[model samples]
Target: MTTRTQTLSQAGAQSGILPIIGAAVLGAFLLYAAGFAEASVLHDTAHDARHSIAFPCH
Candidate 1:
């Protein structure tokens, strides 16, 4: 019953919703980790990342 264009249109619309949900979940996890994680671990990870990116942490 469906035409090719209609089928592709439906698929395209469905695909966009997944990335929005994924970003929301990732954002929530980062927020929780930053707020509740041990200070030393968080600081170490951030320091390493900064150096890895060639950011001067001094």
Candidate 2:
């Protein structure tokens, strides 16, 4: 029983790594893109996104 519990816990921990890596990669991409992207492009993208989500950018 103890061994089974340990195995399940290990499996759960391993499964979590993929999402963490994906988030890290996505964050890096956003940072890099924002660093070099045009100001107007970013603003337009953000504005449209806000309106799409009904976040009241105005």
- Which lDDT value does model 1 have at 16? 77
lDDT comparing candidate 2 with the true structure: 0.69
lDDT string for model 1 (1-58, tens) is 5798899989888787778889999998785555434567775667656556654454
Model 2: per-residue Cα lDDT over 1-58, one tens digit each: 9999999999888786788889999998785454434567765667665556555444
TM-score of 1: 0.38
TM-score of 2: 0.38
Give per-model CA RMSD.
Answer: 5.7, 6.1
Over 4 Å off, model 2: 1-14, 37-58
**Lowest lDDT 10-residue stretch of candidate 1:** 31-40
Q: Candidate 1, 52: how far from true, in Å?
A: 26
Cα lDDT of model 1 overall? 0.69
- Where does candidate 1 stray beyond 4 Å? 1-14, 38-40, 43-58
- For model 2, state the Cα shift of residue 48 in Å: 19
